[model samples]
Target: MEKFEQIFKYVNEYAEKLVEANGLDYLEALLQTLEDTLDGTFEWQVEGANKEDMRKAIQIAILKGMRKSAQPNHQMTPDTLGLLVAHFVEQCFEHRLQHGPIAVVDPALGTGNLLFTVMNALNGNVEATGVEVDDLLIRLAAATGDLIEQPVTLFRQDALEKLLVDPVDAVICDLPVGYYPNEEVALDFELCASEGMSYAHHLFIEQSMNYTKDGGFAFFLIPANLFESEQAKQLHKFIKGHAWIQAVIQLPENLFASKAHEKSILILQKHSEHLKAPREVLLAKVPNMSNREALAMFFEKVSMWREGNDQKR
Candidate 1:
């Protein structure tokens, strides 16, 4: 094999080795079934050398692994997403991770990336609730919950609705957004931007702002456009009137499942008595167009922010 081919094979082998070490018996069983399926598919297609069949097998492996790995979100790279989420959640819940339990919520649970990552990071110090409008996603989240042997209370509700009234200790959401306004609303935000309202994604952030407990924190990943758009400006103007906007992390492009648009993660503290140092937006050019590395850079910065705050306190 060529050097590149050898490296690729090694990577795959190393991944399976890690899975073998970390996975439970149930996960092993599921992986076995998936392996059988892949073997059959590859054997059938090898005669004709059908590339599409190979792709299907890859998808099947991903789907099965996701289900077995307690992932509910389809088209998601759990390892990369989990690493990013767990990193930020650590910063957000470093204090609360000590207590018996705290309230955390993911408005757009998308296959439970934020939800499950938080669960793993906190090591179960938190009780979570997630809401997703997609039935397939809901089912996936439910299956992951079962696999993890935890109650990740999830609801089928629109994230763009008026209010979540009940306060939560932490909020993390990756609001869906596209280049066009209509695409943004229909995909993730789900609410129309009216005369008085700004835009759907921004609305999701604002509503989450209200749901976060006094002094609690919220982490949101929204399109970069939301920060520069006239709508975002007006919304920021309104937001400046209340709460502390701790920091904004501008992620590298293609950091999400879509791997197209660039987004930013904003940390907002709700009903807080104190204001932060007003951090300038941190910009990282995503070292290698890698979503995982980009997200890692994000929470690493967040950790720095938290440490600085701790020193001041």
Candidate 2:
């Protein structure tokens, strides 16, 4: 086995032992054990190994364990797509890094995979925070934060009802893809009645906007029905009124490699009175390609569009 794989195996075994002894959750045990083991140069067989790098790899191991145990309803974004979303955020907000650390939030932070990648892409030029309604996922996110040595504040609260004390620089997430189970929770959303089949994604999008500063960005991975169904027209109108739709990229079916459903990434900038909304939005359909190739193409086209070049396809 590869050296990193060896590290993962050892870490998993240690975490499992901790779970058995202390009756702790898998993620909690994994993180507690890893903190002791990953102090400095670890897995030296891997060239130029550092503590943080090893921690990142171990975090992935914990993520895999979580994914394996995840219920079908969890709706976690695949790691590759999470990386793509992070890349998009980094590219779009790279200029803001010069001013100060950009504050970013994921209202539906599942395992914090999206935040982790975004932090890496922006070279730590971010103050990352998230809210997760799931106890398991929130604990997992906290553990992942410890493993990666990334300081992320995660709140265990309903994303829709959570109040934002301060507006942030950007809001990004793979919005949960189903109806809110609790009607009381659903009632608080702006378009609760007209959100059609699923209110989670739309409501979270609205909540994200609420916490975003004027001229700040919000990105979401949502079902394609959001752009199709007649019920969503109101939501679209609301979006147009409140923000500028920067780009809508129709992702390939099976982009997540399971269920084979078509989804789109909506990149929106909250409207500011000082700046007029663009006359036209960039719309592109991503072709089937390896994740690396697809994300590279995406970043390239978006960079061009932001530079005032009209990007076609």
Candidate 3:
């Protein structure tokens, strides 16, 4: 851990230097730093470091840069939450893993942190795709993938825009909440608000479902009050018509600054002839992550639910 801290500190300092010297934003500078590190220009003894260590070093550097930039939308998914999501993904797709590498996509791929975290947890058994509209973020994501030596294909466009990608086996996202601005584009979506700006998160769910292969899974980190929102009825109807709600795992509230900021993981599997909805949704409220015993029990419950559902199928 101490060694990783040293690596993070060096990377962060070098990125800061580039930000100052080139008058570039911290994210852009961080990308350049990662590129330099990868090409041996910024020389670090990372040859012997494992991929997880390298990923962590890059993540820490990105977090520091985000704090310096102070952009709310630039926030990366917290590592703890990302790891938990990865655990859920691994268990949900355990059957698929036995066959071969699975295709995965992150529509709101900010900095590629969540996607890469899962990729690392899965140990390279993923064909990864990332979609983002921000130029710097997409570039940073690409560089981060290259630095970590993960093969990630990235698309630079609005995630809601028509993607050339084929349906993938799994979808994962830290859903971008708030109203979607493009009303004209919103009109094409069934979840579009009847009289006002449509919730981007809702539309993203719909889009993700459309891009997922039948029987594939989507794991989303979403606002805790997602179903209590103004557009809940429409969103609920859409989800019911198209997918099976597998679980809704509320994250520990203390992880956020306030109750309103708390989020949950919503796991859904696209409808298919071979699959049916779980007998009961696995609704859970996670304990404070520091409580090892409580967390273990929580995951055990999840495992049992998964096993029971699998047997039914």
Candidate 4:
């Protein structure tokens, strides 16, 4: 097993045990446990840190037992949001350690994972704001920001109805695939997810694009259905003519805690000369590891994507 794998195993075990032992929910215990066990060590502070030390840090988080990070009645936190957050952070770091945009937004930020993850990635540069209707999710997310000691703002508002007046530099999100949905078609989420016959899971992809600052990047974890077909072609035309489609990463089913194994990562930048839409979709097997491992692998892949077979637009 790899070094980070050991750490992740410890964290997961600790998280699960703590949740069961203390009768806390998974997301509630995560931030506090993570904060205690793993100090916010930047890339530079991690100089020459051996694998064993990394493993120990994870253990410490586990041994810390419990803290005040849990929230009551949080909704839609069934591990999907955690995985999405991990994926977004991977892309943020893969972008050469440079915070692409100041204002980062996620319209359907379930449990604030997307915002929190980007906050983790940007470390401070990216000002994140997430809009969710659930008050419980909002409170928990706010608590998570406090635990991480980073300000990840969350708003209890309808994303579809209210748009940010301020300009957005980059927008990253993982939209719902429409399992349980509202009736309003004009809702920003439905408008974005409408890909004809079965809504695309990561429908926020377009909303993120529409609001993203010019030349900023748009990264999303979505199904392969968005890759090909005439619908995809038309969408591609809309994006290609306006923005630079950075990379299309095809992932396995394990990428998220979903039944559908069909998955992929779509990277888009608003009009950039540095990146070009990939003609051949890059394939990647989803790591069967925990959410953290999946995220680590995703970030590692972002670095790989930057170096691998790519075209200059």
Report lDDT (CA) for all predictions.
0.58, 0.72, 0.90, 0.55
**Candidate 4 local lDDT, residue 236:** 60
lDDT of 1 by residue, 284-306 (tens): 43344345776467556666767
Residue-by-residue lDDT tens digits, candidate 2, 59-108? 56666666656466444566566666776787676667788798988888
Task: Name every residue pair that clashes in candidate 4.
Answer: 37-61
Worst 10 residues of 2 by lDDT: 37-46
Expressed as tens digits, the lDDT of each residue in 51-72 for candidate 4 is: 3344234333423322333432
For candidate 1, what is the lDDT? Answer: 0.58
Order the candidates by lDDT, highest first — what do you get? 3, 2, 1, 4
| Model 1 lDDT, residue 218, Cα | 81
Error (Å) of candidate 3 at residue 75 is 1.2
Better of 1 and 4 by TM-score: 1
- Show pairs that collide, candidate 3: none
- Candidate 4 overall Cα lDDT vs. reference? 0.55
Candidate 3: count the clashes. Answer: 0
| Every model: Cα RMSD to truth | 10.6, 4.2, 1.4, 8.4
Where model 3 places Cα greater than 4 Å from the true spot, the runs are 311-313
Candidate 1 residue 57 Cα shift, in angstroms, is 14
For this target, which candidate reaches the highest lDDT against the unseen true structure?
A: 3
